[model samples]
Structure formats: C-alpha cells, structure tokens
Target: MSKRYIITGAPGTGKSSLLLQLQKEGIHCFSELSRKVIQHQQKLKGNKTPWGDILGFAELIYQKTIEELKSPVNEISFVDRGLADMTAYLTSQSYFIPGYLQHFPYKKYYKNTVFLLPPWKEIYVNDPQRPQTFKEAMQIHEHLIKTYKNLSFNIETLPKTTLTKRKEIILSLI
Candidate 1:
C-alpha cells in the first residue's frame, strides 16, 4: 500500500523548513502551496488578503496532489499540508467547507497517521503576506489538532526539535 503522510501545523511552525529538509534527504515531500501562492499574488497584485489567497492555492495543491498520487512511486509521499488541513483552516475562519471535499475518500488516499508540528515562537516570522501573530499561530495549531481528532485520525503532535529528529519521528510513524 502507498503510504501518504501529512505534515501540518500553524504558520511559522517550521512546516516548510522541515519539509524542505526532508526533500533534501531524498524523501518524496510536497512543497507548501500557500507560500508559493502568496509569493505569486504579491508579485501579481501588490497586496491582497492572505487567507483568501491561501484558500484558492490550497485547492489547486489538492488537485495536483491527487493527480500525483494516482501514479505509483517507490518512496512514501508526504504532503506539507493535507486536504483536511485546508478544511480546518477554512472552517476556523467561519468559511463553509467545500462540499466536494466530502466526496473525496481521503482516508482511502492517504495513510491514517498525521504528524502535527507544534507552534514554535522562536522560529515564527511575519513576512509581508504571512502576518500572523504568535498567539494566532497557537490558536490555529489547537484548532488543527481538534479538527483532526474530530475526524478520527491518528495524530502525532511533534515537538520543536531538530530537523533530523523530526524526520526520524515521522519515518517511525510511517
């Protein structure tokens, strides 16, 4: 069976940094779509709502991920943020979760384990697009954990540790 892992956390929790490290280690890891989209939007439209851009970009990423997952690959796949993570973000913002998401059998597509990165204040940085405060990141982190638990997923909350240790923990879970 193809194992699909989700590495998720609030903004500034080193989700992207850790995933980039894993990719360097030759692990099959998907990049964070939100950062890319934010960069694109910043270049295209001076300034815009970060949340709105993230929502649209996340949808595109999900489509691309599903397509990629369709083809067989030797190594286990790790998505920086999964579809459920997007739903949780939108839901927390009081946005209606898209109906199509309910149709996708996510459990069938990915492994049951979800690795959640805890909010790390030391690494939190607010750029032009990602202007979230540390408090907000913590709130989002808690919401993500609750959302995944509500969905009955086996979640492992990872601590703020060295990149190598994080990778080792994730590998053990998969």
Candidate 2:
C-alpha cells in the first residue's frame, strides 16, 4: 500500500507553496480541497462556504477528502490536509463535530506522521480564498495540534523557513 503523508496547517501557512514545489519535484501530492470549494462556491454564488455556512462547507470538504482518498496511488503520496483538519476547524468555530467524522479511522488511510506547518506571521496573508487573520490562524494552529494529538498521530511541526528547506526537511523525514 502506498503511504499517504499529510501536510496540514492553518490558512496562509505556505502549505500550498510547499506542496507545489514538492509536486514540481515529481512527488505525488493532493492539494487542499477547501480553497477549491471556496472558489467554486464563489463562482456559483452558492451557500456552501466557510463564511456563509460553515457546517455545509465542512461536509463538502469531507466528501471531497473521501473522494481524493479513493484515488489510486502506486507511490508514496502527500495530502495537503486530512480529516482531523475538519474536526479542528469545527472545534475552533465552536460547532459540534459530526459523529461520523469523530468516529472515522483516519490512521487507516493516512500515515502516522503528519507534518504540521506552523503559523508564520511574516508570510501569512489574507486573500480572496483565505480570509483568516494571522491571530485567528494561530488559534486554529493550536486546535489542529490538539486535534491531531488526540487522534494519536505523531505531529511534526515544519519550521518557518524557505520552501526549498521545508521541502528538504519533509523529504529527509519521510
């Protein structure tokens, strides 16, 4: 079975940038689904969005993640985020996490080691897709750490550094 490594963190933490570089290096990578969902909702003027309906947005992301997991992979792959991220987001927003997600066996699909990119204030920025402030991002970061730890996955925080270095670190670790 191919090992599916997960690279996760709060918004604007350079997860996408690192993943892009990794993909350029010929590594199999699954991009984050939330941003895509947001863009699609915006284009369609739909209600499934974080700002409009968070619960609905969570369910959408959950479904997208499930579909992504079903894709065939012959080599070790990296996922931009994992199911626990949805739990973390819901928890941060004070919403009740769904029991289906709460009971899901995340370890059965993802690797035990999850690379958590810490919030970088210097590099963090708000855009059309990512509107979270740096402070909110930090709070979400804490929730992500707690959620993943509670799920019994080894949390590895990627240092705040250049994309090349971060890529090197992940490649070295995995």
Candidate 3:
C-alpha cells in the first residue's frame, strides 16, 4: 500500500517549502490545494475564498481533496495537508460542519503519523493567498493538533529550525 504521510499546520508555516525540498530529493509530494484554490478564485474574481465566502471555499477544497485521495500515489508520498484540516479550519472559524465531512473516514486514507509545523512568529509572513495574522495562525495550529489527535493520528510537531533540519526530522521519524 502507498503510504500517504501528511505534513499539515496553520498558515505561514514552512509546509510548502519543506515539501518542495522533499520533492526535489525524489520523494513524491502533493501540493496544498488551498493555495491553488485561492489563486484560482482570485483570478476569477470569485467570492469562493477563505476571506470571502469561507464555506464556499471549503466546499471547493473538499471536492478537490476527495479527488486527490481517490487516486493514491504508486509509492510513498507526502501530502501538504489531509482531510481533517478542513474540519479544523471550519471549526476554528465557528462555521457549521457540513454533513459530507462528518462521515469521512480520514484514518483510512492517511498514515498513522502526521507531521505538524508549529506556529513560528519569526518566519510568519502575510501574502495575498495567506492573510491570517500570527495570532490566528497559532489558533489554527491548536485546532489542527486537536483535530488530528481526536482522529487518532500520531502528531509529530516539527521543531522551529531551518528548513533542511525540519526535513531531516521528518525523514528520520518516518
């Protein structure tokens, strides 16, 4: 079976950079769908964005996430985020959880281990796609850890270090 290791965390964490490095090292990795969705929505001038219509944005992400999960990679792969992240995001925003997400068997699709990058204020920066403040990022980090724990996944919190060291930590753990 293809092992799908997920690297998830709040906005501004180094998830993308770490994943990129891993991919360059010949480890198959999946990019985060949220950024792609955000950029697409921006280009279309649509309201389906986290800052605009959060629920609508989540729905779009949900559909894409399902499509990606349906087709597993042939070898071990690392995903930028996992299904449970939507739950964390929605809950953190105090939005209603949709029925479709309530019944998702997340454990079946993800490996037992999930790596999480804690909020680091030193590296946190706001971009067009990510506008969440450092404080908001910390809150999201809490939600992500809580949701992952509730789903029975072993959460590994990556250290606040260089990107190379972070990648080494993950590779060593797995």
Candidate 4:
C-alpha cells in the first residue's frame, strides 16, 4: 500500500521548507492547501483574511487533500499538512465545522506514522504567508499534537535540526 505521511507543526517550524527540500530530493510530496488558499485570498483582497472567503477555501483544501490521497502514484507521499490541521484551524478560530466532518474519522485516510516538527522559536519568523504570533503558534502546535493523539496515531516528534537530519529521522521511523 502507498504510505501517506503528514509533515505538520506550528507555523514557521519549517513544515513547507522541509517538504520542498524533500521534493527536491525526488520524494513525492503535496503542498499545503491552506497556505495556497490563504495566498490566493490575499492576492485577490490585499489582506490576509478576505472576509466571507474562508469557508470556500477550507472546502477546497478538504477536496484537494482527498484527491491527492486517491492519486494513482504508488510511492510514498508526504502532505505538507493534513485533515486534522484543517479541523484545528476551524476549531481554534471558533468556526463551526460541517456536521459531516465532526463525525468523520481521519485516521483511515492517512497512515499510523505521523512526523511532527516542534515549534522552533529560534528560527520562527512571521511572513506574508504566516502571520501567527509565537504564542498562537504554540497553541496551535499543542492543539494539533493533542488532536493527532486523539486519533491514536503513532506520533514521532522530529527534532529542530538541519533539513537532512529531519529527513533521516522520518525515514528511520517509517
């Protein structure tokens, strides 16, 4: 079976950077849908939160993730983020998730092994794509880890090290 891995962490923890580096190394990976949607909204509205546009963007992420999971490629695939990340965002922002998702089980779609990068304050930097404060990132990171634990996943925390070392840790775990 094709293994699906989620590379997730607090914002600015190098989730996207590591994924990009892995892709450059010829590893299959998918971009974070939330980042893509956020960028698109920013471009069209000149602001981060384009009021009345988040729901649609969230839905797009949900659909795109499912599509990526069902792709024909039979290689290991790494998702920059995962479905649990979406739920955490909505829940954190006090937005109501659709009823279907409230009862949906995400563990079935992904694998048991989940690689999480801890928040690295030393390298944390806010950018146009990510505007979360350090405290907020920490909260989200804690929430995400709890959420994944609730799903009974085999969680492995990757150290805040060089990209190559992180990749080695993940490879060894899998």
* Tens-digit per-residue lDDT, 123-172, candidate 3: 99999999899999899999999889988899999999999999889889
Q: In order, what lDDT does every prediction score?
A: 0.76, 0.90, 0.90, 0.77
In terms of lDDT, the best-performing candidate is 2
**In candidate 2, which residue ranges exceed 4 Å CA deviation?**
none
- The positional error of residue 131 in candidate 2, measured at the CA in angstroms, is 0.9
By descending lDDT, how would the candidates be arranged?
2, 3, 4, 1
The number of clashing residue pairs in each candidate reads: 0, 0, 0, 0
Q: Residue 147 in candidate 2 has what lDDT? A: 97
Estimate the TM-score of every prediction: 0.85, 0.96, 0.96, 0.87
- Give the winner by TM-score: 2
lDDT of 2 by residue, 1-174 (tens): 676999999999999999999999898998889989999999998978867899999899988988888898747789888888989988998999998799988988889999999998889889988888898998899999999999999998999999999999999998
Instruction: List model 4 lDDT by residue over 119-162, tens digit each.
Output: 99999998877888999889888878877887787788998899
For model 3, the stretches where C-alpha displacement exceeds 4 angstroms are: none
Ranked by TM-score from best down, the candidates are 2, 3, 4, 1
**lDDT tens digits, residue span 1-174, model 1:** 576788899988888888888888788887776666567777887343446554565566567667766867555778878777767777667777676665667787677888999988888899876788889888788879977887778999887899989988887777
Between candidates 2 and 4, name the one with more favorable TM-score: 2
lDDT of 2 at 87: 91
Q: Report the Cα lDDT for residue 163, model 3.
A: 90
Deviating ranges (above 4 Å) for candidate 1 = 46-50, 53-65
How does model 4 fare in lDDT? 0.77
